[model samples]
Target: MKKRSFADLFFLLFVVYIVLPVVATMLYAFAGKWNKTILPEGWTLKWLATLFQDTAFIQAFGRSVLLSGGAVIIALLAIVPAIFVIVLYFPKYEKWIQAAVVMVYSFPGVILAVGLIRVYSQFGVPMIVVVLGAYVIGILPYIYQGTRNSLRNVDARQLLDAAQLLGASKMQAFRKVLLPTVYPGLFAGALLSFSVLFGEFVLINLVVGSRFETVQIYLMKKLSTSGHIASAVVFIYIVLMGILTFIIAKLTKQAKGATNV
Candidate 1:
């Protein structure tokens, strides 16, 4: 009974620790005035309204979506098939793929950005394109893990062999059998990658700067001007992340259900 009481108290403290800041930020975003009080003096939506009316903010949000979506699409198109081939036919090479995924993390964002600028700037290549390419490769670990786990959970080899023995081509078997079975996990990975890239700042800031202002850069620029507006931006960002997390959870549950069947 004493241990149970301690556990409950610990859980309450943990919840407060995690939730207090978010609640405060949300209040500040909508609060007309909040100073030295437990609650705001009054509440208003003026900050959020102001944010929505700003063309620069809208553009930044759009750019973030485009960059993140583009990266995920490129990853899906390239990585999915490569992983399928590796897992299905060339299983011995999977170790090399794992090594490459681990190597992605060896270079910090600053170093990677500097290296990219040195290599790509000399050729006059647009930094946005370079960043896009880097984003695709950066997400390999998520895509690889999600896809590999999905395939492993489903006895992919037997499914593929059965499809092929039934007079289906290897490509056909992959498309009709393997893809449906694994799409939920693939989509969950894509969502996770999108969320990560959407909030990325350091590489994009160093690589392209204001030439391509993403949501994070925009938020950074707004920080000095108004606290309320910054809080509003953060609120919106948190909402987006929450939605993506919910969807990813649903897809993961579905993937597990499919695998179990």
Candidate 2:
């Protein structure tokens, strides 16, 4: 009983530690004013209203969606096939990919941004595109891990063989059979990538600042002006991520179910 009580107390503290900040932030977002109190003095939606009505916020939100979505799509188109081929065919090359992912993690965003600027500034390539390219690369590990895990759960070689035995060409077998089989699981990776890229600030800020106003940049600018508005942005961002997390959970379950079948 003593051990059980101690464990329960620890778990309770852990949950409080994680949830209290979120609850406080949510309260702050909706708060009319909070001063010298444990709870908000009053509640209102003006902060959220202000956030949505502001053209800059709306634009930032849209650009964030576009940048994150575009990066994820490009990674999917360019990286997914390469990953499939690597895992299913040239798995010996997987170690090289692992090394690259490790290197990507080791490099700080500031270094990557400076390197990008120095390398691409001479070529007249748009910095936004460069940032987009880097975003795709930044997310390589997430996509690769998600796709790799999905592929591991699946007997992709057997699926390819079975498809080929049914008169499908190698290309057709890969495209129609193996790809769809692992797509749901792998798609979770894209969502994770999007979430990560959506919150990214350093690369985009250094690459293209006022020109491309992503949500994070907007939030950064707002932090000095109004706490409520900033909190509102954070609240909405949390909601958006919560939705994506829920979708990821669903996709993962669906992937597992399909695999079992």
Candidate 3:
């Protein structure tokens, strides 16, 4: 009983430490006057209203959605198949492939940006190519690791044997059986990649410059000029992430339960 109580207290403390700042900042978002005060003077929705009305913010938000969404789709389409191939067929080259994927994360963003600029400048790549490249390279590790982890639950030998026994072709077996089993992980990876790319700023800022303005860039600009509006944007981002996390948790849970049942 005493140990349980101590563990509960510790967990509560950890949660409080993590959540208090978020709570405070979210409250500040609704503050009519947050300056020169211990507490907000009053609460109002005007900050949120203004935040939603800003044309630059709106455009940046849309761009973030587009960039992150497209990046995740492209990442999944590319990575999932590659992982499946590595797992099912090219097991001999798994280490090399994984090392290559992981190396993408190891490259410093600034260095990568410089190299990309040099090559793209010579090749005359468009802004869209640069944006997509940033998104893919930045989030590659997250998707790769997540997909690898998700593949653990799937029994590869069993899948291959079942396919052979049923006279099903390798492609059909993979498409029908292996793909379904690992889809939860793929979905998780996609969501994670999307989340990472959503808040990503460094690569995009360096590569695309003013040609692109994502949510994070817009928020940074606001922060430098208007702290309150910046706080509001941060609050919105927190809320958005929370919603996405909740959805991912629910979906993952449902998937696991279905598989178990």
Clashes per candidate, residues 3 or more apart or on different chains: 0, 0, 0
Error in Å for residue 94 of model 3: 0.8
lDDT of 1 by residue, 1-261 (tens): 999999999999999999999998888999987788889899899999999999999999999999999999999999888998998889999999999899998989999999999999999998999999999999999999989989988999999999999999988998999899999998999999999999999999999999999999999999999989999999999999999999999999999999896
TM-score to true structure, per model: 0.95, 0.95, 0.86
**Off by more than 4 A, model 2:** none
Top-lDDT structure, candidate number = 1
**By summed lDDT, which 10 consecutive residues of candidate 3 come out lowest?**
252-261
Poorly placed runs, candidate 3 (over 4 Å):
1-20, 258-261
Candidate 1 lDDT (Cα, 0 to 1): 0.95
Model 3, position 127: C-alpha lDDT score: 63
lDDT score at residue 101, model 1, on the 0-100 scale: 96
Per-residue lDDT of model 2, residues 1-261, tens digit only: 999999999999999999999988888999987899989889999999999999999999999999999999999999988988888889899999999889889999999999999999999999999999999999999999999989988899889999999999999998898888898988899999999999999999998998999999999999999999999999999999999999999999988889985
Question: What Cα-based lDDT does every candidate model obtain?
Answer: 0.95, 0.93, 0.80
Candidates by TM-score, descending order: 1, 2, 3
